[model samples]
Each structure stands twice: as structure tokens, then as C-alpha cells.
Target: MLNKIKKQGFLNRISSLIIVQVIFVFAALFLIIFNYSTEGSVSKQINEVGKYQTISNEISGYLEDNISSLTTDNLRYEYIEGELASYDEILKAEILTTDKDNKLTPIFSYINSVQSVTNEIPQTYIESIAEHMISEFNKSNLKSQFAPIIYNTNNIINLLPLKNNQKTEAVLVIVSNHDFIISNRSELSYAIFLLFLIATLFSLLTVYLIFNRFKWPLNKLIYGFKKTARGELYELMEPEGDVELRALTSAFNEMSKTLWENSTQLKKSNDELEESNYLLSESRSYFKTLIEQSPDSIVVTNFSGNITFYNDKAGKLFGYKKDEIIEQHIDKFFTQPVMNTINNTDNELNGVELLAKTLDEELIPVYCIASSIEDDKSNDIAFLFIIRDISESKDFQEMMIRVDRYYTRGEMAGDIAHEINNYLAVLSGNLELMPLFMKKGQNEKIVSKLELMRKTVDNIARFANGLMDPNQDEAVFEEADINQLIENVLAFLKPQNRFDGVQINTDLSTDLPLVEFDISQLQQLIINLVYNSAEAMQQIEKEKVINIYTQPGNEGDGTVRVIICDNGPGVQSDKKEILFKKRFTTKRKGHGIGLVTCQKIIEVHSGDIGYEYDEGAKFFFDIPLKQKSKEKISEEEKASTVYGN
Candidate 1:
């Protein structure tokens, strides 16, 4: 069916439209000519009626003038006879008068020839005509006074009134025989129809001429185009048509010639391409081996994120056989968040740490790198993913974090011990004093000693709680006051000997809203930033001053901004860019994870942090008042933080 439809020529399609148009035009012309002929006949009949009306009016005027005369016995017959003789078409004429009883009587009648006539008018018409005669006596309303002209083909009857002094005295009835002639109307109509018929024929002939003029050439061109499409490259002869069609044929022939030449050259190129293909086949094997033996897993996917190819390392990493993994969507093996990232990535992804699930449903941390493989058109045809199982590396990172935390704790160990010893001393003193007071029967002193001892124990517990390792804590988000957290951090740090001469200024906003964050991570972030500042200031001979400021962020943003500025030598311009990168540190003993950890903490909270230099080194960060909903963040990902390179 499709082939049959395709075989239909363009002329066939257009011929239907041409036929419809011609039929419509012919119908319109027929209607116009027919209506004109009809109207002409109607107009001719109306003119005859008007002529009859004039004759009736003359008869009514004559009767009105001589009505008084015609009623007299001396001139009645003579006047009626003479008037009726003037109108040769009037078959009958009567002057009707009403008697005292309102009965109609013809005073005078003239018969031109013997013919049937109706004197029986409707009673209502008689009364209506009488009234109209009085109204139209001097107003040129002659039609109103005349009875409606009764026409039977060419026969007509006219009833008019003869009035005297604005009063209808009598009615004049006339029956006439006249043949209305509309000359040459049928001939004119026939002529019009004949002309239109000739026009239609000429139009169709022109259409046929135009169609034939182009049809043969176009069909030949279409054949050539089909041949070219099938690689036959048939040449077309210049067709006899208009300039455009001839030019099209010439161009087609030239194209066919060029293609034939190109075909010859293409054969040689194909031979070279075959040789190149052999080399490419060898290269493909080499790359395949390299990819298989590569330590990192390699997976290739199409635009749909479905796995198209994967090396043995990838199979091993995911615990999937070739049959199990091939053609599966990335989400089948990757965690949802990782799948989302992969789908959203357009060009390239580098060093993204994500979780992947193995065939046994065990999730392991992995580092991923991906890039789009595009063709010459820069369209992404496939995607290449380099996957590395980072489970062992993640374990090592956690260990290193523990070691870093332990080292930090070791640095604060003296302060913790000093705080504990002070509380212990107070308790010991209270214990001895309480015994002494009890022996002396001093109840108030004994109660005071017990209260003091309770307070000292509480202090010791609070200090110990502050010293707890953040690495061992679960990642739990909660609303906390910025000023309160800062005060707690300062309380622990100020009591330490490392800050003996260092002055830390605080300008925290009193009305700051509580922001959601992981408490342990926040504490760790503040500790790292503050310790780095203090340690940076150690080399400066000037007074070491660190200023911390907190304020509400821009309205409607639901964030609070905190700036920690220190009067130490700010970071060098050259090294500032990498200040927060992994393993980048400005401190001699710094592990470089401090700022990087701080950045990661802020990121997990959906916040932003940056550094700027004015008169001093200023580190500013914005924390959202609320964290992202828990459902969007998985427990494992939230619980883990990448701290090192």
C-alpha cells in the first residue's frame, strides 16, 4: 500500500484540487447568470404592471372629472365609451358607486371585447382602498389608492379610486390583456453560459498544458534522485521545460558526474580504510588488554546510563558476571545518589566519592571518574566511567582521621587534666571540711560542703564531655545556637596554655537563629579553624588577636554568616587557591585536613564557606538555618566524611 501511494505522481494530487476549483467556479457562474435572467424577467413584468397602473390612473382621473357628468343621463354612455376606446388593452371598465345602503353599483361600464372579469372584490379590500383614497387625495400616494394589481401571466386587473374633495366617491375597476416581453434575456443567459463553458475548457486546457510541460521532466528528475539515493548515480538529460526545470536537470547531471568521480576515489579510500581498520583492530585488542589488567575498574555506558561494556576489573569489583551486568542500568549497581549524579553529569566528572552495591548487596565506597565520548559532531554517543574500589582507602582514611583526632586530644590533654585536678581538689577539700563540720555539730557548713562537692563533680563531668572524640560520635543533625557553640569552644580553648597570651574577640549576634548541623562536625570544624589561626599567629612577633563574628544572613536566605578573622600573616596569594584542598596546610605540624574537613562539613550541611583578605585573614562561612530533609540523605553517606586526599 505504501509503495502504491509513493508511486502516485505529484500531478495526480494537484489535479484533484484543480478539479474542485473548476467545479466551484462553474457553479458560481451558473448561479450568477441564472439569477440575472430571472431578475430581468421580473423587472420586465413590473414595467408592464406600471404601464397598466398609468392607464388605470388615467381612467380614474377621467371618471372622477366626469363622474358628475357620467352620472347624468345625457353624457354617461358617451364619456365611458370614449374613454374605454382610448385604452385598447382594457377588456372591461366599470365606474362603481356606493348607494345609501353601502351597496356597490356600476354607474357606467365599457367593454372593449367580450371577456370574463371579477367585480367581486373582498369587502375588506374595498374598505381599505376607500380609506387609503381619502389619505392620499393630495399626497402623491397613488399606489395606496390602487387595488393590488392582480396578474395572471400577462393578464392584469386594477382597482383604483376616483376621489373628489379628499373623499373617495367611487372605485374604477379595469381588466386588461397585455403580453409582457423581455427581449433577448434567454439568449443573453445562453451566451453567458456558453462563454463560461468556453472559459472552463480553456482553464482546464491551460492546467493540462502546465502539468504536461513540467510533469515529464519532474518524473525523470525524481527517477534520477531515486537512483542517486540507491548509489546508482544515474545522469539525467536536460528536459524541455522552463529555465528552472532545465537548470535543475543540468545541476542533477553535474551532481551525478561528480558522484561518479567521487565513487572512483572512494574505492581507493576504502582500500586504505581497510588497512587502517586492521591497525585499529590491533589497537582495540591492545586497549582491551590494558583495560582488563588496569587496577581501576573500567565501565562504558551509552547515553541511557545502561552498561554497554565493562572490563574484568569492573566485574570483579561489583561481583557480577558478564551476563549479569551487561546492559543493566547504572542504578542497578550504584547507590541512588551516585546514580543521580551520573545521570545529571553532562561532560565529565572527576574524583566523586560514591557508594556502589555489589552483586551480593554489600555496598562499598568507590571513587568515580566519568566523561562523555562524543563523535565528530560533539554529540554524546556514549559515556566512559573509570571506577576504583576505595573501600580499603576509605578504611585507611578513617584510621588517619582517628589518629588526627587522637593527636588533637593529646594536645588538649594537659588542659583536661588541669581542669579535672582543680575539681578534684575542691572535692577533696569539701570532704575533709564536711567531716570537720559534722563533728562540731555545724549542720549548715556540712550542707554547704555537700553542695560544693556536687557542683565540683558536675563541672568535672562537663569538662570531660567537652573532651570527647568527635570521630566516635554518630552524624546527627540538630539545631544549635552559634553563640553558645562558640562560647563552649572558647571555654575549652581559653583554659588551655596554647592560648595563654592570645586574645580572641567575639562579636556574635544575639538574635542569630539556631542552625541545623552535626554538633560533632561543627565542633571539629571550629577547633580546626581556631587552632590553625592560633598556630599561624605563633610565628608573628606582634600581638596575636583572633576575631570571631556572627550575624544573620540576607533576609529570606535562612542562613547565618560567621567570620573568623585573625591578625596573623594572611595566606600568600599564590597558595590561597589551594588552602582548602586535601593535604594543603600552612602550619608546620598541620596535617592539612583541617580546612578540608571544615569544607566537607559545611558541604554536607548545604552551606558555603570562603576566605578573603582585608586587613587580616578572614574566613567566612554561611550555614543554612535548616538542613536538607533526611530522606534525601542516606545514613551511611551522612555518617561518613572524606577528610583526606
Candidate 2:
């Protein structure tokens, strides 16, 4: 029973209590109604009897006041019939006289309404009621102030004695039936019962409406709390109800909002912390691998030039054990001037030629690059030195550097001559046609030819000056819009005869963020790729279409990808692997330095380039939004002493 009660809902419990109370209240009310109904019915019956008594008294008074009328039976009969027939409750009216030998005689009689014609009431009932009323009348002691006597049976009878000068006389009697009294009591009982039934139905409907008012909002709050428990936090709706219930809902909404805000802030903090830790661990692992696995001797020292870290290569290069190298002054390995130069300068020392000493006091030629490693606050924490022994290969490296530089300059000059000769051919042809147009008196054609020749000459001069400049070798990194660069290259190239029949299509993503690159190198890269594609399609029969696309890199990698493809015969499969190598080209007059230079330019920017054959030659590259920290120097730069690394 207790379990069942506990399982019941709140509304069910409230309804049960209210229903029990209602039943008790209505039961008491029903009793009161029943008592009131009974009293009302009794009062009505009394009123009915009183009306009959009034009729009986009036008949007796009339007979007594007119003694002459009582002396004749005719006069008495006339009076009783005419005056007493009007009362409906009075079933019958009669005057009876007692003669000698005590026998009763009916002097005058009249029956009222239904009973006069019907025998529904037995004749004995009326006779018995009349006798009882007369006995009550005769037993009265005060005859002058005589009152009527009432005898009640299935009908009521009233008796009033008629007297003259203190002598016994006829008695006036009235009979009334019980029809109106019985029916009225029954109707009152039914009305009371019907009223009770209506009250009960109305009470039940009120309970239902009240229960729903509380149940709906409580149910919504319960569902909201359940969701919160499952980590899906949300606010609850404020509903209309009792004040206490509304207050509870308001409190829940406030608490939920607070909890959600705190949870979101905590989650964000955790994510940022985790990302920081991961980057730190990755950075540590990366530096550790580069220092330990690097072919050059890596040495780390404090700002005071005291060695703090020595790798395996460093120990072998200096001919010392690991214990012998720790805490040693860098001047013990290199000359004092080397330490002085590194400490006094703010810039990195790249490929600084110096003599390094061994444990046995012998000196050897070595190339060293030194830089300061700083903390997050930009405070210098340590100095890093990468030293490569050049004892055996110094002369060979110098020769190779000269050969490489000469070859590169020769290739650049060849490419320049090829580009210039194409423009010069256009200039020569226009110069040859200028006189003919002038002789024909076509000034418009002549002016157009002259303009073309002038533009071509100006383009050659600008191109030669930019390409021949020595400072162009060093890349200038800046924030550049990639799509704008492609557009600029296309604008410059489309006016040239090499791309006259070529259709160039560009699909650049508008939302691409700025990428850190060398603008001049990027423009040169585009021009070279476009020129290569145009040359590859010189003999293709199909429409020469080149597609250039720029878009963001893979999601969250913080890079951008660029693609340039042409509908031309792609490179031979056997030659694809060597496509970016120096002096490797299939063009009849090509020096093949363009693709190699493109590769080097991208490499210096810490980006990767690739080529693939997809219906044609497709060249693509991925460049980061920001360049990574330089971990090592390139072989070419390491060949001899170089500065400003």
C-alpha cells in the first residue's frame, strides 16, 4: 500500500485528498437538505389542514349565528352545499345531529371536488375521521371560544361544534386528502439529490483543470533537468502557476544558464591548454631530432660562450669525448675572433669560414653558422652553432660553386635572349609594315603598328633590367594576395604572341587569406609555368586551354594550394622524375633552368611543389600562411662562407 502511494503522481494524491473531503462535505450537506425538505413537506401539510379548519369554523359560525337556519334541514343543506363546495383540500363537508337513544344523523352534507364523484377514498375513512373530530370537539371545556379539532388519517378531517344557548348541537366537519402534501415532499427530495450531483461533476472538472495547470510545467522542468544530466544543458521556460512553482522555474533557468556558461569557458580553457602543450612537445621533439641526426656538428652554449650541449657529431669533429666537451669555452674550439664576431652581431652568422681546433692542438678548416635561440619573451636563452668540417672538400666545393654560378648565369642569359628575340621579331615585322601602311595613306594602321613596336621594345627593356639585376637572387617575403598575382601575370602574358590562341581559365577562391611569399618570385613562378604550358601546346591540334586554380589547403592545415594545368601533351613518363632537375628540358632551344628555379624558389619559402600528368601537365604547390622557423641551411648556401642567413 505504501509502495502504491509512493508510485502515484502528485496530482493523483491531491485529487484523492480533495475527493475524500468533497464526499464528506456533500454527505453532510445532503443530510441538511433532507432535513430541510422533510420540514418543508410537514409545514405544507399543516397549512393544508389549517385551510380545512378555516372552512369548518366558518360553517359552524354561520349555523350558530342563524339559529333559524339550523332549525330546518333545508336551510342547513343549502348553506353547506353552496359555501363549502369551493375548497379543494376539503373532501367533504357535513353537519351531524345526535337524537334520542344516542343515534347520529347527518343533517346536511356536501362533498368537495374529486371525492364527491369518485370512491377512491373509502366511505369508512371519512366516517371514522368525522367521529374522531366530533369526540375531540365535545371534550373541549370552553364552548364559547371553541376551536376546531383535527383528525389525521389517509385524509384529514376538521370538526367544529354548533351550539345555541349552551345546548349540544350539530357538529361541522371537513375532510381533506393527502395528494398535494405527498407529491410536494417527493419533488423536494429529488431536487436536492440533483443539485448534489451537479456540484460533484463541477468539482471533478475543476480538479482536472487544476491538475493540468501544475503537471505541464513540472513535466517540462523534469525533461529539462534530464537533458542537463546528460550534458545537454539548456534553460527552462517560466510558466504560469502558483507563485512558488513559478519561482522554482525561474531559479532552475538561472542555474542552468550559469552552469552552461561556466562549462563552455572551462572547455575552451582546456582546449587552448591542450593545443599549447601539443605544440610545445612537437617543437621539442623536432629540435631534438634535428640536433641529434644532423650531419653537421651541433653545439649549444650559454650567452657567456660556455658550452652546454654537445652532439655526437660535435665530439667526433673536435676529436674529444662527450665529457671533455661539456662546459668548455667556445674559444677553445674556434679562435677568439669567431666568438667575438658572433657575440657582437645581432644577425645570424651564415657559413662563416673559421679554423676549429682539435683536442690534440691541430687546426682544420670548417664552415660554421651561428644564431641565438630565444624564449617566448624574446630573451636570448642560448646560442646554437652548426659547424661543418671542410678540411678535405674545401677546394672541390669552391670549384662546384663557381661551376654552378656560371651555369645558372649562362642559362638565365639564354632564356633572356630567347624571350627578347621573340619580342624583337614582332618589332621587326611591325617596323617592316610601317612604311607600307604609310605609303597607302592609312594613318590608323600606321599609328597602330608604331604603337605595337614601341610597346614591345618597352617590354624587352623592362624585362632585361629586372632579370639582369643581381639583388633579385635574394627572395623578399611579404604578405601577398595569390589571386591578384595570378591576374597580374595573366595580364602581362596575354598581350604576348606566345599565348595568342590559348584560352586561360581562372577559378580562384575569393575567401583565400593572404599568404606570406615573395611577390616577385610568385609572379615569376606564374609566368614561367604559363610559358612552359604554352610552349608544350605549340603543336597540339586541340584548343589550347590552361586552367589556373587557387584555393585554401586541406582543412585546418593553415596553407593554400595553387594549380596550373594545360591541355597539352604532358611530359614523357620516363622523364617526369627529372622534370625539375637543372638543365633537363625537351625544348629545342630551352636551357631548362626555369622549372629548376621554380623548385628552388618554392623550397626557399618552405613550401613544396609537384608535377602530375592529368590530361595534361599539371603543376601544383602548397604554401603555408606563415613560414616555419629555419631548422637548417641549404647545401648551396653551406658551400662557402655566406652572411645574413
Candidate 3:
């Protein structure tokens, strides 16, 4: 039964249940009303006979009250029957004896022959009397009633017992028409019918409203599910419903979107895989070369530190042939820890570094890792060591140390400059007072020499102040024309010391935009770089030339790019990684802060700098068209404190 109903839609099933509930409730109420009407009708009629009972008691009291007159029993009986007959409601009255005969004698009666159910019974005024219908009432089953009896819909009769001083037992029986229950039942039937109509209407409206509230959200979710099953994408309207329905809706929408995205990605991957299949053999060859041509040499040594097997890269790194180093102790190329780490079973080794001796007797740095495997002999094992050279990494570490030293030096220079400035300021004030105090100050010789001395002091002060001011964070950005800026810097550099002999070339792009930069700091960077290039070229007899190039950045990205290349011997392989590092210079008298300062200046502008060695060494950088934000820091920012004696 449940399965069959489940096949139906939600509205149909719910409506069926609600309808059955309403009908069942109405039927139960109707049965209860019918039971009450059947029994209550008879009991209600019996209680209504209290009016006639009161009349019988009043006549007995009257007989007692007037008995003091010494009236005979005949007089009493006549007065009782005639006085009771005047009442309008009394249909008939009789005195009865409960002897073995159970006899009854009619006294007086006034019955309403008109038999009107809706009219009021005449209790105050007199009612028209007719022959009492005793034969019909006696023939019916109402004779078995012990008290008042209700016959059909309009008839009422009562039996009352009475006593007299003569020791006689008599009963009063009265019959009348009082039919409130039957008439009330008719009106009540109409009220019951109206109540049923209202209840049914309310039940139907409630079912409809509840069903629609559930139906719309359910229908939307069902439609969404169906669309997803068909591999079609659809947008879900924002739900304003119960929590459970919204959760179901959201889950379905998310599932559909995820599946669609997965399908698209899967198709994209398939296409890419198919197209790239043509290069499979090429890729395999490339991967093979990658292993063979690896920069890190592969070497395996036994537990005795003897060379067993190595790739070609190992030979290149150690400067020895495989045969030459076959039985040679690995200690020839590795330090003591290599032997200790390889033999220690408790050691964890993966690329542990050691100092190695090359064929030329050079102490080169190398990283080594070794593992062991058990041999055929019990408790015997062999070790394999993989060694790679890390000379560049060592060079970078040393360069950073030197950079730290530079910061220390700059800090000292600033302090010394500050002291010198104080002295120079006092001297300037003293010198001005000198001319005023001289007696013959206007003499040509004195004036010319004093003026020369003053100029000399001024120049010294400028140099001292310049040293005190490092380009740490005094950022003053302004628009710069790249094409013109490079040219002017080169022209100014052409006459500086050794650079006077070097040729300079420029490949400036005319279409480049004006970029914002710190002018004074960038000028210092250009001068230091060009001068360093010239100093390097002075040693070599080759034609020394410096080439400078400027262009718009790649993809018109609103940046200015610059390249400075030198035709001297390119950077050596050992120093390639640390070429632009701080405080690692080739010049004998160099402070080693030229390239470092250049990097710092570029960083302040939010740019990048790098160097590469090809036919010659080339340094390049790209700066944004405008400084991100201009903020200045003092020279103390770039320096650390120094300990004094």
C-alpha cells in the first residue's frame, strides 16, 4: 500500500490522508450525537412532568386547609376536580388506588385537541377542552410508564400518588402537551449540518495551503536533479524555504557544477595528452640526456672509501679518468667525515658535504651521500656514495660575510664624516673672522691666497658630507627620461680617469616612457658600474669597450629595462653565482659595495637586477614606470655598529 501511494506525487498522497482524517472525525461526531438524541429524548420528557406534580401537591394542601370547616369527603372531591379542570395545561386528571385492582378514576381534564407543537401552552388563560383520548393512550405501550411518559412528539402524562386522613391511598395522573425536545432536535439538525460544512471547508483549505508550501520547493529540486542527470547545466533560483529543502537544493547544484568542471578538465587533459604523444621519443631522449648530463656527479664507493663506479660527470668534476680513480681511496677526494658517515650504521646521510682533493691538488668542496647493501657473505655490506660539487654555494656564503664587513665599514665612515663636519663648520666661522681682523685685508696676494684656501675647505666639506650620506632610505623620486638619462651618465663618465681610454656604445630606445626613480642614487650606481668596468679592462690589452642598452619592458608592461655589457673576459664559472653579491670585487682598491649598492637602489624602486655570462658579462634590470611610493631612510639604516678599542 505504501509503495503504491509512493508512486503518486506529493500533493495527491498528502491530500488523500488529510481527507480521510476529516471524514473519520466527522463520522465519529455524528454517531455521538445520535446516541445522545435516542436516550436523552425519553429522559428529558419525564423530567418535564414537575409542573403537573406541583398541581397535585397544591390540591392536597387545599383539602387539608379547608378540612377545618367540617366539610364532607364528597365536598372535598368535588372542589378538587372542578378547581384543577380550570388550568389550561391539564389535559386530564384522575385519582387512582394501588390496590389489587390497580383501579383508576378520572377526576377532571382539559386536553388540547388542536395539537399545536409550535404554540405556547395556555397556563394563565383557559384552553378549549375536548374529549380526552384515553382509549388511544391506553392501547399504546405508554401504559407501562411508572412516572411521566412522553408519547410520540407532543404528548406528556404524569402519575402522582396521594394520601388522605381516612387511610385511603390514591394516585393523581395528569396528561398534557409539552414537546421542547422534539422541536429543539429539528433545529439542532440544521445546526449540525452547518457545522459540518464549515469544518469540511476549513480542512480542505488547510490541506491545500500545506501542500503548496511543500510542493513548489520539491518541484524545483526535482527539476534540477533531472536536468543534471541529462548532463545539462542550469542555474538554481535562490531558495527561501525550509532548511531541509534548501540543503537538498544546494547539494544538487554543487554536485552538478563539480561534475561539469571535471568533465571539461578531463577533455582538456585528453586533448593535451594526444597532441603531445608525437614527442614521446624526443622526451625520452631529453630525459636520458638530463640524467647523463646532470651537473651533480654520481659515484658509488664501497665501505673502504675506494671508488667503484661513477658517471662521466664524476670524471669532469674530480679531473680524473674512471680507470685512474678505480681503486683509489675516496679519502683522496673526501674529508674524514665522509668515511665516518659511510661506516656508522646509526647515521642518516643524504647529500652530506665534504672537502675533496682534485687531481690538480685543489681542495674542492663536494656533497656526498652513501648507502649500504648486504653482500653474499654474512654480516658484510657495501656502501654507495653520490657526490656533487657545491663550490658556488660556498662562494655565496663568503660573499655574504664580506657584505657584512662593508656595512660595518660604512657605519664607521659616517661617524668619521660627522666629526669632520663639526670641525669644518668651526673652521669656516673662524676663517670669516680672520679677514675682518686683518689690518691689510685688501692686499691682492692676501685676497687671492685666502680665496683659494676657502675654496679648498669647501671642497673637503662636500666630500665628507657625501660619504656621510649613504643611499640607505633617502628616497626622492622624480620623472626620468631613460634615453636621455643613460646618454648623459655615459658622457659624464667618459672623462673619468681610466674610462677616458675606453670606448662606449649606446643603444637607447627613443620610444621609451619616462619612469620615476631616485636620481642621485641611480647616478651613483651608473658611475660605480662604469668605473668598475674600466678598471677591469685596464689590466687586459684588448680593446676595452662598454655597451649600454635601454628599451621598453616586455609586453609593453609600463616598465623601463636597461642592460650594461662589457667586452672584457667574461666572469669565471667559480664566481658566476656570486657575481652581483655585496663586497666581492675584482679591483684591488675596491670597497666591493658597487654592485651591492646598485642592488639596494633598485630594490628601493621596487625593481629587480640580475647578471649572466655569455660572450661577455652582462648586467640587466627592469624598473616600473613610476616608483610605487617614495619614502626616505637615513644612511644609518644600511650600516651596523663597530666595536672600538
lDDT of each: 0.72, 0.71, 0.62
**Residue-by-residue lDDT tens digits, candidate 1, 287-368:** 8889999999998988888899988998888899988888998778777645467557656787787778888676666888
Error of 3 at 601 (Å): 12
User: Candidate 2 has which clashing residue pairs, if any?
Assistant: 91-175
Give the TM-score of each candidate. Answer: 0.41, 0.30, 0.30
For candidate 2, the TM-score is: 0.30
> Which segments of candidate 3 are over 4 A away from where they belong?
1-298, 311-324, 332-532, 539-551, 554-559, 565-645
| Ranking of all candidate structures by their lDDT, best first | 1, 2, 3
- Give the TM-score (vs. native) of candidate 1: 0.41
Range of the 10 consecutive residues with the lowest summed lDDT in candidate 1? 141-150
Q: Give me the candidate number with maximum lDDT.
A: 1
List runs of model 1 lying over 4 Å from the truth: 1-403, 443-451, 469-474, 634-645
Better of 1 and 3 by lDDT: 1
Question: How far off is model 1, as Cα RMSD?
Answer: 32.5
State the number of backbone clashes in model 3.
4
